[model samples]
Target: MPKAQETILEIDRSALTHNYNYLKSKLQSKTKFLAVVKAFAYGNDAEKIAKHLQWLNVDYFAVAYTSEGVALREAGITKPILVLHPQIVNFKTIIKHCLEPSLYNTNVLNAFITVANEEAQTNYPVHIKFNTGLNRLGFWESDVDYIINKLKATSSIVITSIFSHLAASEDANEADFTVNQIKSFKVIATEFLSKLDYKPLLHLCNTSGVINYPEAHLDMVRCGIGLYGFGNSANEDKYLKPIASLKSIISQIHKIEPNETVGYNRAYVAKTYEKTATIPIGHADGIGRHLGNEKGYVIINGQKASIIGNVCMDMIMVNITTINCKEGDEVIIFDGNNKATDLATSLNTISYEIITSISQRVKRSFIE
Candidate 1:
């Protein structure tokens, strides 16, 4: 590996391909696979991941916005792209790039209808997102008729897919709640499709739903975290490989005497003489300040090293006395052995926060 000048996020494309194939094998042969590559492919590199997935013949790609979809398109990705949370203001650009938008509100639906008609489009593909239980985005069940009516009024707008999100698909204890959500989505979707005289592709299973509720897998599945080797369950984790690894080199090492304080506000007061290795990464680089004050740790030489004090804007101090490490040694922030989920648990957050929180400032390196 090249010498680490700064914190680097290493992306494993082979592991990503493995995860994609594993998830694809779990679904029925007829079921299509939609790879979600939003949030810079969850803080890795979207264009890189999308290119690899394209090589794997992924059925579709989904992003949170039109800009993300455009990025993939510009990267020569010709596969169908779905913008999950598109805004009306970008409807023109979305259409220009042949990107499909998930119409979750009446205003958005109307705006798309106007644009489609003005553009003289016929049978333009779009997804309708229903609010199952997430309550974040998506049209409510009561809005189904309005959506169907609007679509019926315009031949330009075509319903390509209908989907919903599961709020707690990974929890076994939330099985009943998830079941209820699936049932509700099915009922609303069935009623709307019956009125339309045609059926669009139906998909509700995310990574968690694909693992926990096979029955909920409808016409397709959208796998995001699963493609990145996080299944939200121990069983799934065993079968997956993390597609990203974060590593940083120790910039310098200092031997501190007993009673000496470390970092800002004297957050870490040494009780005994110890060696500290300062790494070139910090909250500004998405490590977060909460990771300081001994709240989180990184792995060095296969052993845990705790953060000694407040995480600076571009540096962190790790107690490395026991590790026998020196300056320029590589430290593992999160990887296959010590997962980011472990750090998230320590900081009382989820792996998504830990992964997505990684800022663009951190350099990204792709390993094929």
Candidate 2:
């Protein structure tokens, strides 16, 4: 690998393909794999990743907004794109880009119908989002009848799939709650579809759901984090490989005497003579200030280096006394060896936050 000028996120396409194949092998033979490319493919370049997955014959692609789907389309991706949290204002743009919207409520559904009709569209694909237990978005079970009735009245809209999100699928302790939510979703889907004389593909499995609840893997599975590696459970981790590796180079080195403080606010007072290396990465680069002050550390020369003092907006100082390295040496922030989950645990956060918090300023280099 070439030397990095600053913080760089190395994307391993081989690992991505490995994780996708692993997850695919775990799913039922009839279930389709929908790669969730929202949040820029979980902060790792969505367009490129989506195109690669499309080449691999992925069943579908999902994004959080119509613009995200539009990006994929612009990249020449022809796979079916599902917008999970589309706004009413973008319904026309969504229709124009041939992106499917997940109508979470009656208002969105009605608005999409109007736009589709005005555009002289016929059988435009749309997904129905049901609020199983997340309580964040999606339509209520009671509104199923109203949704079906409206769909029946409109000829331009077509229900492509009915899906729900899993709130606590990763937590084994929440198994009962997740099971109940799955049961409720199934009941509502069955009752509502029967009344409409329709059978849209039913799906309600996320990364953790697919791992924990095999029976809930109905017709499709939407996976986001698993594609990037770091599964919800320890067992799942054995089968997944992380695709992102964050690396930075040491910008400078300093020799500190005993009792001397490092960085702003004198947060880290040296106990003895120590050598610290300042890396060209900080809060502005997604290494939050909170991660400083002894909350987190990085790997240097195969050894752990404690982050000393406040993490500046553009730099961070790490004690390199134990490591046999000099200025311009490489340092690992989070990678295959030092998992993002481990860093997130040290910061009292989750892997999702650690990965998604990576700023766009970091240069991304993909390895095939």
Candidate 3:
């Protein structure tokens, strides 16, 4: 709420806690919770988010890469970290940091085994990902025997969990597909446990999956966007508090005549006398060019101000003619009232794209 800062991303810790508790309320007491803090916690500062979740006693933390896990460890994150897409070269670092890698394929499984053995690690914990239906990652269900054979061939890494991703748990039309995917995962998990002589945690729910498929909440659940206050559905979004609010201030105001044009390529031509407000945020700041030329709008004086002209690398122009706003007036790009989901929908995208696309250069202010 600083008056001078041109652009700032405000992170509400209370909202995050509220979201966590709300999501937790939906789960049984014994089901573990894994907070996905990958992509810098969806560009909202993963270190801070993870630290808060750690204090809340979240059962686990997951990231998209080993480097993300290393960053968390360096930041004093002591809880077990799961690297979702760990690379073979980073296996040593993963072991050094005591991070668990999701071995989705035979090559990665074998490569991680080599590293764990070389490091003299015994019974190192690793998670197995099954290709239930996503087909993006994970070993095939048909390859379950091969997976078990590989695991039995080595005691260097132990199976800690078997998980997979849900592609469309949020879509009501895909209910049948989601159910089938869950069924396939259950069969694979049961076979794996029967063969391994040990039971690893089973999980197959992301945010949407957590909401739509409670029965599939085997032993744990992974939540990413839901933790940040987006449910991917209007009804669910009504119950979640968005944690991040992207705000900025009008740096300058201009008066233009009917003949005048604005921005690169003269994207905007005034139809009449118009007042414009230049905000110090643009494509470089993650408000992409796709959001320009009246495609996106900002809230000024609690009124909508359409973004006019093309978005520049570090600035954007909004038609503030009717808002009666001056330089330094606060402008909210997206927040609870003007939801990021709505903004992304206007751009033919999703809330995740809009929220995570916020650039790191923008200052993040945490509110507790």
TM-score of each: 0.97, 0.97, 0.98
Candidate 1: TM-score? Answer: 0.97
Which candidate gets the maximum TM-score versus the true structure? 3
Please list the residue runs of candidate 2 whose C-alpha ends up more than 4 Å from where it truly belongs after superposition.
1-5
Alpha-carbon lDDT of model 2: 0.91
Give lDDT tens digits, candidate 2, residues 318-348.
9888889987788999998799989988878
165-189, model 3: which lDDT tens digit per residue? 9989999999999999999999888
For candidate 1, lDDT tens digit of each residue in 191-266? 8888887889999999999988899889999999989989998788999999989999889999999999999999
Clashes of each: 0, 0, 0
Each candidate: RMSD:
1.4, 1.3, 1.0
For model 1, state the Cα shift of residue 86 in Å.
0.9
Model 3 stretches with alpha carbons more than 4 Å out: 1-4
